[model samples]
Structure formats: structure tokens, C-alpha cells
Target: MESTAIGLWGVPLAILAGAIRVSTPFIFVSLGETITERSGRINLGLEGTLVFGAMTAYAVAVMTGSPWLGVLAAMATGAVFGTIHGWICKWPKVNDIAIGIAMMQFGLGLAFFLGKAFIKPAAPHLPSIPFGAWSSYPQIQAALNINVLFIIGAVLAVLLWWAFRNTRMGLILRVVGDSTDAARAIGINPDRIRLLATAVGGSLAAVGGAYLSLYYPGSWNEGISSGQGLMAVALVIFARWNPIGCFLAALLFGGAGALGPALQSVGVSEGYYLFYAAPYVMTLVIMIITSSPTRSLSGAPGALSITK
Candidate 1:
């Protein structure tokens, strides 16, 4: 009986560990998307930016022997991608969504092309705080060996949440998202605001990519992202465009993502591949539950196309 109880507890504990490990990317990407969406722009090309960021980060870390500098390089790369997207989207009759898709392809191609040589080269790893040092269990210690990016992401969420509600810049972003006409009437340059927002968003998303290469999987490859950037878009919707909500939603999705592996570890593996789809299924279900054709979801930006 005691063994059974312990086994049951292990599942949840493992799930929590999974959440901690997996939520970092979600946190960074979703928050970046939040910033872009709030400025009445959407960049589906974040998928590309993420891949490129990962490649750049890995390459920089390997050459410089500094993970932090690699992170900065990734941010710069992401910003450049965002600037290109912003510049092109400003053209008349340009479709941001289509451009995003194109960018995604371009990013993937570039990453694969440049990262081909980096496949075998090892890079310096990011630092992690040992919160589980007090625990005697190895599993607990492993679980607590989380990267610093997680804490930074959490802090950014809280700060963004407060800024969105209390800061002048946040109000301007909200107004722009709600109505370009309103923003113009108030002397705000909607296009400029959106461009800046997208740049910042791209930088943040790249930070998540840095985390992937410098920490988690800790390698350079074409398959580093695995749709994490795209999933983050849906996560933003489920989070109702709130930065704090994005953080919580990320943790939940991260846990669901870890479910398949956790179950397989304890000798229960009936549908291994199918278990991997848990996160997508959860996203679809949540979309259905939260969506309304007649009314906009709570916290959605009015001018954003995704909500409609």
C-alpha cells in the first residue's frame, strides 16, 4: 500500500518537474506574442525567429564560450527578423500572416544551412539554481536544477502584467490594439508603436530559443524548436492576452507535454506516440471552450485578426 501511494505521488511530482523544465519556452514566447498582439500586430513568423535564434545562440555560445553573450546574439537576431517583418508589413496590401509563413520558411532554411556545421560542436551550458539541494532524493535534486531563464521569465510576466495596467506605454499599446483610429486621434503613431512592439516581442521570443539551445536540449540542430513557437500563439489566446495568464497557461501546457514521458517511465506505455499529442488536444479543447462567434473572448485586443 505504501508503495502504491508513493507511485501515485511520483506521477504528480514528475509532472511538476516537467512543467518547470518545459514552461520556460512557453513563457518567453507567449509573453513576446502578448506584446506584439497588444500593439495590434501578429507575427506568425515567430516560428522562424525561434529557430534562427536557437541556431545563433548555439553558434555564439560555442565560439565565445559565454552563454550570456550567446543569449544577447539571439536577441539581436530575433530583433532583426522582427524589423524585417515590420518593415515589409508596413507596405500597402501586404499580409502579415502570409509574410510570417514565408519568414518561418526562410528562418528554417537559414538555420539548417548555417547550423549544419554546428551539429557536432559542443557549447557552454547556461547556469541553473539548485533549489532542490535540501532534498535527499536525486529526483528532487534533478527537478530543482532549473535554468535561470525560468525565473527571469516569471519576473518579466509579473512586470508586464503591472505595466500593461499602470504604465503610459502600456495604455498606448492597448489603445493601438483596440483601434488605430483612436491611437491616431490621440497623436500616437500606430505603425511606429507596432513596429517597436514587434521588435521587443521578437527579442523575447529569441531568448526562449536561447534557453533551448544553451540549456534544455543544449544542442544545435534543425529540429530544435519542434513547433514550440507556433503553439505559443494558441497559448496566448488561451491566456486571454494577459501576461500573467500566459505564464500560468504555459505551466499547464508544459505539464501536459511531460505526461507522455512520465507515464512511459513507470512501465505504462500503451500509446507512446499518441501521448505526445496531449498538448495540442488540450489547446484545441481550450479554444473551443473559450471561443465565442458572437462575442470576443475576454482580454482580447479588438483590432487583432486572430480573435475574429
Candidate 2:
């Protein structure tokens, strides 16, 4: 794809493509976090899980020559990590947030130590759908290249939003999240539900990591994730714990993050670097806008407020 062939429209088209590519991880992580938070637990260690999952996915893909298998491995490891966090936090007087921080460092160190041999290996990349193939323009073709995971993430968002409202399991999760006493009276174990929710969240976050290593930037590195896991926590909050809102917010964040590269692609390089900070800046702004000391978030679980 030559820049001369792409007109001024290339910039926006490129940004749109970048937004979809960049948003995949955010969508997975934010949706996963929504599930965890809805069950009244927050996993701050997801950054570690995300990175570690990236490493695991790359290593597995290199060894097995199957990107999908690598993704499965990452999900399994993430489940283990989540289960550990849940188990530790269930103990008397244990602090979930503090444990999550410790786990973050632990995951990072472990990944770097184990992934040294995998740094140089080439792995199979995930496949994408060329939505713009009908167009003669190269820029359009490149811009509309949508990956399988992004499509799955988008569908999952809608499914989750619907499930939360209509499913019996969803009702149980909501009840467990809202009040411990109420859950107990209803014969549901809050600890157990939170544990399962956290485990599921961990797996989902890992899938996001797999997408990063197997597609998009499409490589394994220590810095593959730029605090996206942490950013997703605020995103879940900003979305008011709604699954559909999480999906849309991820796209917004993704588009913001993509603004810099999109402009640079069109030869507008000078100030585009500043736009690279869009994701972080947007996260901070949304957090400030949504936070209130006296009132809980509109859709927040009642039990989660005590942690604040």
C-alpha cells in the first residue's frame, strides 16, 4: 500500500481500521472486568495476566504451529492465575486489591523469566476478513481488514448484555454481587460466585492478550501491553458495568489510541505523537467525570462500594 495511491480519505479509513485492531484487547479485557465487578470483585492483576498471556500464547504458537491452541493455553493459564487470586482473597482479613498488585508483579516476573527463549521465534498469525475486498482502493482494503477475534468480541458483548438481563445465571450473579446477606438467605455462596466470576474474567483477559501476540502488533514482547489491562478497570466503571457500553467504550478508546498512527500514515507527523496519549488521557477524564465520594455508580453492585 503506497501513500500516493491513498487520498486524504486514507487517514480516517486507516484510523477506523486501527480502531478495530486496537479495540479487540480493550473489548475483551473490559467485558471480562465487567463480569468480575458485577460479581463484586475487582482484579487489578489483569495487567499481569494480559502480559503473561501474551507470552504464553506466543510460546505455544511457536511450539505447536497453531495460533488457536496457543490462545487456549493462555486462557488456561489465566484461569489458574484468577483462581489463585480468588482463593487468596477469600481468606479472613485478606485484601483483594493488595493481592492483585502482588500477583501483577509475580506474573510479569514469571513471564519474562520463562519467555526468554521465545523472544526470537516466529509464530502463526491469526486470520482476518477482508471486508473491503470489493473496493479497488488499497487503503480501503487495509482499513477494513477485520480479525476473527474482534468479531467474536463484538458478538460476545451483545450476548453478555442480553444474558445479564434475561438469564437465570445472570440473576444469581447479580444477587450475589448486590448483598452478601441476601445471597446467603437465598442459599447462594457469595465467595464461590466471586471465585468463578474472577476465573472467567481472567480467561477473557487472557484471550485479549492472545489477540495482541497472535495478531495486530502480532509479536511477543515484554511491553506488548501498554497498561490496557489497568485501563479496562476504569472503562468498566465508565461503562457503568453494562456489557454493551463496555464494547462501545473500548472502540472509543481504541479510536483515540489509533489517532496518532492514522495521522502519521497520511504524512501528518508533527503533532500526531501527542495523540498517542489519547487512550490514557481519555481514561483519566472519564474516571474523574464518573467518580463521586458520596454516591455509587449508577449500575454498580452494592457490595463493591464498600471497597471504595
Candidate 3:
């Protein structure tokens, strides 16, 4: 079947499609970080974790011929990385930021060294839902081919938003985030809560990585994450640690990320490359606008060191 081209109209369609496709990773990473930050901890090493997860997922998919298994493997490894970071930061006098940075380097180096063998092998890809089947246009079909993980991420966001407002666990997380003394008064262990939160965050971040290698880019590469993991830290702040906000913000960021590729696809070659930087530029702008020397961000966790 021949693809139906719609001329200039393809640009917006491509961007709409790309936004959904590219936003999946951002959605996952930002949601993961939202959970971690809400629990009063920050993991700057998520970039390393993201890359390492991509490598792990790709390697496993290549060996096992099952992308789902690869995703599981990535999640397990990510949780372990998170556990290490959480445990180290729990030590007296240890700085979470410093430890997070170290873990990021460690994850990156380990992934690069071990990923060398599987770089060239083709891995099984995750399946997508063909929502555009009724359309005759190929671009519409491509745009509507929604991945399973994207749906999962969307559901997860709603679930998380509800959980934060209506669950006992959410209450505990909030208490711990607000104050260690308050958590202690309530017979809760702040360190334990933070550790578990970090581990959960790591697992989710890894899922984002798996989406990259097994779905979108569909390959293992050293630079696959494109600093998206680090960017998620900023995204969590941008979303005010709200799961629903994270989802919407991820979509916006995804659209910005898609700008360059969408323009190039439409034959707008000149100056299109610069649009690739739109997401990062947007991040910087958001940070500058939100930051204030005199007042802490409204939704920031009281126990979070960055807020202090």
C-alpha cells in the first residue's frame, strides 16, 4: 500500500505523533522522580540509571527474544541502583546529591563497558496499539500507533495522583517528606520510607529506559537518554511533584523535543537542527522563571535538601 502524503499538513500531524512517541520516556522518568522527590529525596543519578537500563533491556531482549523480559530485567537493575543510592545516603553525614552523582557515573561507566558486546545485535521490540487503522493516510496510521507502555504510563499517572490524595501510604510519604521529626513522632521511619521511595523511583526510571531501547529508538546506544534522566529532575520540579502535572508537562516537553524532527520531516531543513535544543532550552527557561532568591518553591518538600 502506498503512503498518502498530505503536504504541509504533515508537519502538525508529525508533531502530534512525535509528541506522544517521545513523551513516553519523559512521562515515566518524571513520574518516577515525582515519587522520589515527594518522599523527600532526590536522585540526580537517574541519567546513569536510565542509560544502564537501556543497555540492560537491549541486551536481554537480544538474548531472550522477549522485550517484556528485557523490561523486567531493566526494572530489577534500576531498583538495585536506587537501593544503593538510598542506602548510601541514609548514612550520617552523607549527602544525597553527592551520592546520586557518583551513582550516575558508576551506572554510565558500567553500561558502556558491558554494552559493547550487544550494540550491533537487533532486539525484539515492544508492540503498539494501532489506533489509526481506519485512516488511509500512512502518517495518520503512524501517528496513531500508540505503544503499550505509553498507555501504562498514562494510567500510572492517574493512579499515582489518586494515591497521593486518598491513600494511607501517601499520607506517610507526605509526613516523612514534610519533616523527619513529624515522621518519627508518628512512629514512622523516614530513612526507610526514603529508601523504598528511591528504589521505586529507580524501577520506574528503568522502565522509561526500556521504552527507549525496546520501543522508540529501538536500540542500545551510549547517548540514548540524551540527558533525559537528568532533565527529569528538573521536570519533577516543574510539575511541582504532581503526577498528573508530570504527565502533561512530559507531553509538552515531548512536543518541544519533536519540533526539530517534525520540521525536518516536512522538508524544512534550514535552522531545523536548532529546534532539537528546544526541550533543554525550555527547561532552562522554566527554571529561571520559577526560581526565586527569597522564597522556596511552594510545593517543594520541606525535608528536601535542595529546597533548603
Highest TM-score against the true fold, candidate: 3
lDDT of 3: 0.92
lDDT of 1 by residue, 100-173 (tens): 89988998899899998889999999999999899766667777788899999999999999999999999999
Candidate 2 vs. truth: CA RMSD? 1.4
* Model 2 accuracy (lDDT, Cα): 0.90
**Which candidate model has the greater TM-score, 1 or 3?**
3
Q: Kindly state the number of residue pairs that clash in model 1.
A: 0
- Alpha-carbon TM-score of each model against the true structure: 0.95, 0.97, 0.98
Model 1 regions more than 4 Å off:
1-6, 290-292
Instruction: Identify the leading candidate in terms of lDDT.
Output: 3
Sort the candidates on lDDT, descending order: 3, 2, 1
By summed lDDT, the worst window of 10 consecutive residues in model 2 runs over: 1-10
Query: What is candidate 2's lDDT per residue for 1-308, written digit by digit as tens?
Result: 46467678877897798899999999999998889888888899999999999999999999999999999999999998998988888787888789889988998899899998998889999999999999888888888889999999999999999999999989988998888789999899999999999999999999999999999799988889999999999999889999999999999999999899988987785988999999999999998888778776788898773346
Instruction: Give the Cα lDDT of each candidate.
Output: 0.89, 0.90, 0.92
